[model samples]
Target: MKHFFKIVYCIAILCIADTSYAQRKTAVKAKTTTVNAGLKLPTGFHASIIARDLGVARHMAVNSKGDIYVKMDRVKNSGGIIELSNPADNGIARKKTVFGEYGGTGIAIKNGYLYASSNSNIYRYKLNADEQVEDTGKAELIVSGLLDRGQHNSKSIALDNDGNIYVNIGAYSNSCQEHDRENGSKGMDPCPILDSAGGIWQFKADKQNQTYGDGVRYATGTRNVVGLDWNNEINSLFVMQHGRDQIGTMFPQFYEAKYADEIPAEEMFLVKKGMNFGWPYCYYDPMQNKKLLAPEYGGDGKQVGRCAEMEKPVVAFPAHMAPDGLLFYTGNMFPEKYKNGAFIAFHGSWNRNVTGQEGYFVAFVPFKDGKPSGKWEVFANGFAGVSKIESTGDAKYRPCGLAQAPDGSLYVSDDNKGNIWRITYKGK
Candidate 1:
């Protein structure tokens, strides 16, 4: 009888051990099934999918009441801007509403108003006390009649605290070439496109029915600026310009295919009034760390030439990364290292051949006293969810916009999948 009882006791001990092991395995599987499983973030950061299938979600803004407004790159489901509300504070949104008629890539919330942009116009809608759009039909045109000849036509916008709105008017030409991207094509000196486009224009934020004539050309010579922000810390405007393309195809004599793939660096600049960044005239060489005259403008890949006087970039990223969104981090939920730093959503490179496609992720540039202080690091990745992509269509998600919520969570939007991800840090 003593031996029988001892055998029974051993069996019980084994059962308990097996059950505990099984429970641990189940818990780990549950974590892996969460929305953030595909995302790779910092040590304490976690991401949750707040909404999906919202239709070509581009740039987005978060209101004080935690409502999300996203601009679509195209008119999907008969609308352009979509709003998400989550009164329960859960990761999932309870109500989704779509409004606005124009599709674009910019959206913002400033001073009791929600601002969005189409390819050719900037529109503003007044927000109610609950921070929702009062009426989509009452949307006022803050600025209209900007150029939108299709190539580089996104009129991304940013607003300042001083009642000013900044709009990007992209140049239609690739490099203002006389023949437009043709080999041996010469550039048009005094590029006529700069007269009305290729620059940032400042206008009144509250003024309605204003045209391009009413706004002042704030700065000149940017090729195209999709990523722009008013840095409240520095009390100035900063812009990221999409560099000119097709170096080898146009000027193979001076540039090999490999060199063309990585010659010009995408630039971010602290744009000031009347500043010239030398588009259609110069391109920054990341390896040389110097501005060289463009091939169409009489450069042989080594000549600084007339581009010597052009303003240099504050920080230059790798070529073809296609930065589409810029936000200065002011939230406290993140670690102290991220305060006042710049977060850039690199919409990813589509034309890479030599180094393969890159930049479908979000990067962080540490800032000290309103200036970039360290090397830029990839903060969020796996939007593409693949190790390598042969083309842009292979990417699962292309990050297009970024916004910080009032409660300090960060929101990222994807134009490819129309998904919005909310990232938060829960570390104590």
Candidate 2:
């Protein structure tokens, strides 16, 4: 923790002020400086950055008091969770403080305590009445030493209303076995990884030192679910999966080059306990519009036989868009049409050899009750810039994180250039 605060002290200096009034005013002043979003808004729709210049800010959660907590990568332990509090009415906020050097990828606020995860482990940080980081000595490991494959390593987390914390343990390999793409890369019989990796585990949110060795697998066979959210309306957990990569690169006969950009759909899964979405062995095909068997298990591009018993996605999207954040709208942030919709941050794609850029935008999937009711739409754009190519290569600002403010406003984080944007709507 000593090394953790050394970097934070410099960030805190920019936020601290001599007086309370000054702090609040600064927040509001920052709100008015936003770049215009055309003259179409009725009035009062404002957008601005909360905090900027941080590496690879991924998942984020806000507290009851409206403080923002972000799980950033590489700030010691790959990255510790940082808190931003006292957001101004004008939309300006400050990086208040940070703790928990264990640096896991998931962070959330549930039942008065702050929960954070590091690769290989999970921890619970106790907070005081003000909701500031209070030293409960060191954080208790809620779950530890999970499957820590360097690929797809950021473990996203979500908590059910019933007090169960769900953590993602992604599959280490691309497609399970080599028979996957090559002429003959055979899958491990029974794929033991399905038992541990490529799954979501449930643990007692208030318990102590509960490592992966003791936790129960809540769901299985997902590739890497980076965006996990609990919708109290449905009383279930929802996750957006970062789908598998390179169908043709690894296996040309099974899939063509065009299929790389147009094949699998990044899935929006409504995760229930004991659910399994097949990975390494199966993929959701946007072209054929069904779940297809992966090439690894002696299956071709269109076979669903290998995934007969697996679960399917609630909503389907284009391939390789890389959804990094998922949030359901419940606040008055936009029109009534958006009240129950889900906003997803597509971190963009690298698979398309066809043409130009995609996924450098935030998308919205409307939900009525618990099901998707309408086609998804682009909620925000301009991240790709006016004209550009070379996705995953020449991105100056890629949308990587999404968080809904307490006021129904949405915040998007850019990983390439470390900027946080608050997007709000005032028109009907």
Candidate 3:
């Protein structure tokens, strides 16, 4: 009888463990199933979850045949790029292929080649007549030895019609301080880091094995640009610059803690060759609508100083929004108002502790004659799934990449869960 009782006890223990394990598995599945649960769209727009659990989906490109190639923020299972083929009319991808061994933030399809970037290198693969990559193993190295200090290390890429490829080499330090990110640290004179980084570099799109010396520093003094697009409409390049951080924490004498979150504006620039945007030495103040000298350079938070000579942003957004992807919408599926406009993906903010967090949504900037025609508006929202985001980790989804389909559908990728949302226009 004692042996039988012990056997019954063990059976009960096994049953409890099994039930607990099943509950845990179901919880994880529930999280993924809520991919587009709280996504909000504008009138005449609807969204669907085309892919999920894709492993840090970053910038993506859709080919002529509607195949999507997405770059992963990090390599998973030896694959960094994911290909989705044969998407159904219901917005579901019928086939998913994961390839490439390297990973970074930039990917684009131009001409007959598919271009992608690692943190320190740029590579291209020839596409077949079907617009699919011909050989995944033979990625040609177009640019190499770019700076990657791993602090603002995402290398976003944009290509021009003139066979030139532009890459952003982000500044590693916050403000080029003599002692990085330290309180009371003075700015480094001339900022040697800008010699190789803190700007956009241009290289030959078709050339192989090109290094820093082989490329031209197209523009200078941009702190870190993650979102950039070549405006074929205007024959120019546009970029969104992430402003500096911790003005109050680093220099409280000059800026109050409450004002730090709103002082430096995330700037949108009409980039021109040899133009200086002024980073480390200056930051844009949206309140004043002017570029102001950075605190490290001895400004009292309101002085323009040398920043008066820097190029001003065409549009300025609230500070710390973390713009990650930019796409010029030239699609016919949407209303005429959306044509030639710009869509930006804000990966959301992390450092806006005092003001709570903002910006887990995509914004649209109307363009006329290649310049912003009107004020920017939030095109998509509810990505955070919560009314208030006290911290970035509390958000359910962070919009990181933007792509437009051949049929004029807009695709937004979430880096948090690797979910891709396909948004289409459905006329009323």
| Candidate topping lDDT | 3
Q: What lDDT tens digits, residue by residue, belong to model 2 across residues 1-428?
A: 99889779866775574456697778656544445431112345556566777666766777767788877775743337667774656456777766656554677878777787777777777777867557744677777778887877877788888778998888877777744334456877578777678888888887877777667888888889888888888888899998887776767787767776676789999988888898877888876778888777666887789687889999888888889888888887688878878989888888766755578888898899999999988877666553565757776577877777777777777777667777777663
Taking all chains together, the TM-score of candidate 1 against the true structure is 0.90
Which sequence of candidate numbers ranks them by TM-score, best first? 3, 1, 2
**Candidate 1 vs candidate 2, TM-score winner:** 1
Report every candidate's CA lDDT.
0.88, 0.76, 0.90
True-vs-predicted CA distance for residue 299, candidate 1, Å:
0.4
For model 1, give the 10-residue run with minimal summed lDDT.
86-95
Q: Which runs of model 1 end up more than 4 angstroms from their true locations? A: 1-35
lDDT of 2 at 208: 77
Model 3 earns a TM-score of 0.91
Estimated TM-score per prediction? 0.90, 0.85, 0.91
Candidate number that wins on lDDT, 1 or 2: 1
- Where model 3 places Cα greater than 4 Å from the true spot, the runs are 1-37, 86-88
Model 3: per-residue Cα lDDT over 1-428, one tens digit each: 99999999999999999999999999867754553445777777877788888878899999999999999988887888999974646567754677788889999989999999999999999999999999888899999999899899989999999999999999999999999999888999799999999999999999999999999999999999999999999899999999988887777777777788786999999999999999989999888888998988988888888999999999999999999989999999999899999999998998885888889999999999998999999998877877899878889889999999999999999999998888888886
Model 1 C-alpha lDDT per residue in residues 126-215, reported as the tens digit of each score = 999998898977788888888999999999989998999999999998899888877777899989999989999999999987887899
